[model samples]
Target: FVDVLNTMLDDTLPLTPPEWPEWGNPIESAKDFRTILSYSPYDNVAAKDYPAILAMGGLTDPRVTYWEPAKWIARLRATMRGGGPVLLRTNMGAGHGGASGRFNRLDEVAIVYAFALWAVGMAEKAEV
Candidate 1:
């Protein structure tokens, strides 16, 4: 979502816009709320055999909740014919703004980035 904004808006929009994009409509350019939720970046995470889902949800966020990602994982987990890691990082302390604690935020970001890299087999994890 941020990637799309940074790409499309480029220099037009400020770092933190006075008013961000509204809720409901979500497609890149299709311009309809119904179409947005049915298909978009959201659907990309849906099962690709044994997809590695980096599902994160802010418990305090009204838009995206811990339950949303949990449900997504439940679907993916159900369809993963091959057993794999579907990392769910639900930050209990985070709002839509994200995690606030210093060390915890560092861990949160690292885990998410690392999980993404690890998911694609681009980075190796050390056995503990």
Candidate 2:
């Protein structure tokens, strides 16, 4: 949480106008911590059954560090009651947008699509 907050403060905040109410400094709001905690997906996770989750991260993603998803999946695996095949796929050579070439991008998209199909129990139907 701190890392994400710091990133937003240091990286994203500068790009936005300070006077923008919606994008105002997080520390300036008294409800900042509470509000962020309330809506945070990581903080809200509980020991309950979940559908298959396919978390993909890029090595060079500026907006979100790869470890965030890695840690989230770790937590989910540790506490989830059942009903999941939580998976994490880290791209060794990609960034936020993914692989560089057009064909490489298509390959990445195909992988995600295949995961979605398998998650929903449609992998067999997708056979070519």
- What TM-score fits each model? 0.58, 0.78
Over 33-116, each residue of candidate 2 has an lDDT whose tens digit, in order, gives 456555566767799999988888889875567887888889889999999888888898888788889999999999899988
- Range of the 10 consecutive residues with the lowest summed lDDT in candidate 1: 2-11
Q: How far is candidate 1 from the true structure (C-alpha RMSD, Å)?
A: 7.9
Summarize candidate 1's per-residue lDDT along 12-120 as a digit string, tens digits. Answer: 4343233235433233344543444454443444445665667787888654445657766776776666646776777888887678879878978888788778777
Candidate 1 wrong stretches, greater than 4 Å: 1-34, 40-48
Off by over 4 Å in 2: 1-26, 125-128
Query: Cα miss at 7, model 1 (Å)?
Result: 26
The clash count of every prediction, one per candidate, is 0, 0
Model 2: which ten-residue window has the lowest total lDDT? 1-10
lDDT against true structure, model 1: 0.58
